[model samples]
Target: MAGSLWYATAAPGPVLGPLTASVRAEVAIIGAGYTGLSAALRLAEAGRDVVVLEALEVGERASGLNGGQVIPGVKHDPDILEEMFGPVAGSRLVDTVASGPDVVFDLIRKYEIACAATRTGWIQPATSPATLEVIAARVGQWRRRGADVELLSAAETARLIGSQRYLGAWIDRRGGTIQPLSYVRGLARAARGAGARIFSQSPATDLEETHSEWRIQTPQGSVVSAMVIIATDAYTDRLVDPLRRTLIPVPSFQVATEPICDELRQTILPEGQSASDTWHLLRYFRLDPTGRLVMGSRGTFADVPVAVAARHHYRAVREIFPQLEGIRYEYHWGGLVGMTRDHLPHLHEIAPGLLTGLGYNGRGVAMATVMGRILADWALGMPGPELAFPVTPLAPIPMHRFNQFGARMVIQGLRAMDGLARVRDRWSARSAPGLSL
Candidate 1:
């Protein structure tokens, strides 16, 4: 199987050469994912000289490897965000993320990106009655904030998902999916067209702050700019110690089946909406434009074999969609996701004129795009109060060296809990009158 289904499917985009000479720009961005590329596009559009330094080809890492779900909101609940950041700032944060998919689709239209962009919406299915209540609370909270979300009954969810495994669901019309690699590549092309200098295979190995400018050093070149934005999320390096330590990188593995027959496709996600269940170790799935079923789940961060990790996802697919039994998987891949301590994205000003945005948990698609714009606005002298997420100081995680061990333990615990929850849910269902499936 191909390492990445996205790489096999997405059309080739622009090929930018590596940087070989020192350059100066008004702003320098490290990393070439959605956040960096989007920021470069905005900054270049504003007539500022911008340079994007990428360690590899754009979207070659997490950006290209992630499931293409364009989900809305950060990892935390809306009400919790409101309570943590207070009413005004927290509400703005909620609204900003709630509109994330709109921002993404708008960019696709404005740039005429050819990524198989779909706005059919996203569904969060509840695996049990307790999870259904959680989904209900989420739907109500978003609805009260004027979001176009609805709670689905058990029958409604089953009909939509073509699976009776879910108790209910929360459907958010604002969410959708995209060809992530193509989208990121398109953003890079747009940024270049807007006059942002992008260099591939040029990693920012060192950074230093001069009296009034930031100096970023690559292997073959260097960039001197008034400000710099470190947009590398899960792929952060030792060049940015504080930012790297703030996130625990976890592995997310995915597999995509060969295109199914049209008849079978019609019975699976018939509405073409993306869906994920409410398990602690969540399982997410969606149909590609060509009717291929793509599913993903958590994997080990260590050097565990890919096939071993993938067995879990394969079992999940069989359990959820028995009709897909014996289907051939054409691709299997995995990438790291930067999980923050609080399960929310962090925007921090490491020092004067040096900013960093990372730690999206797993919702990097829309949130990263929105965060790019936020970083651009901040680079353009926007005040902290005006941004959606609060700009705070970077805080390194304690005992950071043990993060890998901790992450593995957490995944194991979550999986065990999920197994127990399934047993309990089935027991409760059989005991309740008229609830047995």
Candidate 2:
């Protein structure tokens, strides 16, 4: 099987070469994912000289490896965000998050990016009655904000999702899906078109700051710029040790089946939307443009083989859609998601003229694109107070080394809890008088 179905199916990407000599620009960005490329495009279009150095080819990391769900907003709802960050800051954040999908779709249109972009919506289904309250609460918050969101009854969810297991769901119309790798690659093409210099295979190994400028050293060349942006999310390194420490990079694994029969394709995700369930160890699935069913979940440790790692997802696919039994899985891949102590995305001004945008906590497609634009705003001289996201201190996570073990344990416990809850919910429903499936 292909390591990544996206890679196998993606159109030819832009040809970007490695850096061979030192260059100077107004701003230098590290990492060539959505964040760096988006920031580069904006900065370059603003007539600023920008240089982007990437250790690998564009979208080779999290940006390319993600599940391609362009979901807007963070894990928290708008009301909670406002409560946590105070009305003013939180409101700004809410607005920023709400517009994330807008930014992504706009870019795709403005740049004419071809990634099989779809804006049908994103569905978060309740696996059991216990999760209905949470889903309804989330729907209520978005509806109160006058957002394009709605709650779906169990029948509607089953019809839309082609799954009778779900009790209900909530959907955000602002959410969508994309060919993640192609999207990032197109961003690189657009950024270059806007006059940005991008170098693939150019790792920013050393960073030194003088009185007014920052110098980044790569394997074959270097970049000297007035300001620097660290856009690496889950693939962070020691280039900024503190920044690296602030993230818990967890692997997210995915599997894709060969194109299903047209009948199955029409039944599953028929509205062309994607879905993620409410399980503690959540399961997210979607249909690609080719009709392949893609399923994703939190990954096993690195040493596990792809087939072995895919056991859980295979089981999930069977339970979620028994009709897909005996389908052939054509691909498997994984990437890291940078989780912060606080599930919120952070924008940090590390020091004067040195800045960074935080990880998206798995909401990278739209959020990362917006974050890149935010980084560009900072580089364009926007004050920290005026930026959409609040600039907070970068504090390393405590006992971060043990996060992997904890993540594993959490996954196991959540799996057990979700299973028990579903069993109980099924029993209660069966016992309820006059209730029918």
The per-residue C-alpha lDDT of model 1 at residue 300 equals: 64
RMSD of candidate 2 to the truth, in angstroms, is 4.2
Q: Write the per-residue lDDT of candidate 1 for residues 1-437, one digit (tens) a residue.
A: 14888998886778898899988999999999998999999999999999999999999988888899999987767898889899999888898888899999999999999999999999988887766777788888888888889999999998888888888898999999999899999999899999999999999999998888999999999999999999999999999897899998888999999998988888899998998777878889999899999999887665777888778888998888989999999888988988888888899999999988888888989999999999999999999889977987799999998976887887888787777766675523212111110
lDDT, candidate 2, 1-437, per-residue tens? 14999999886678988999988899999999999999999999999999999998999998898899989888887888898899999999999999999999999999999999999999988876756777788888889899999999999999899999888999899999999999999999999999999999999999999878999999899888889999999888999998898887877899999999988888998999999887766789999988999999888778777676699899999999999999999899998888876777789988778899976888888899999999999899988899998899988887777875676666667667656765675522211110100
Residue 330's lDDT in candidate 2: 87
Give the number of the best model, judged by lDDT.
Answer: 1
Tell me the alpha-carbon RMSD of every candidate.
3.8, 4.2
TM-score of each: 0.96, 0.95
Residue 353 error for model 2, in Å?
A: 1.5
Worst 10 residues of 1 by lDDT: 428-437
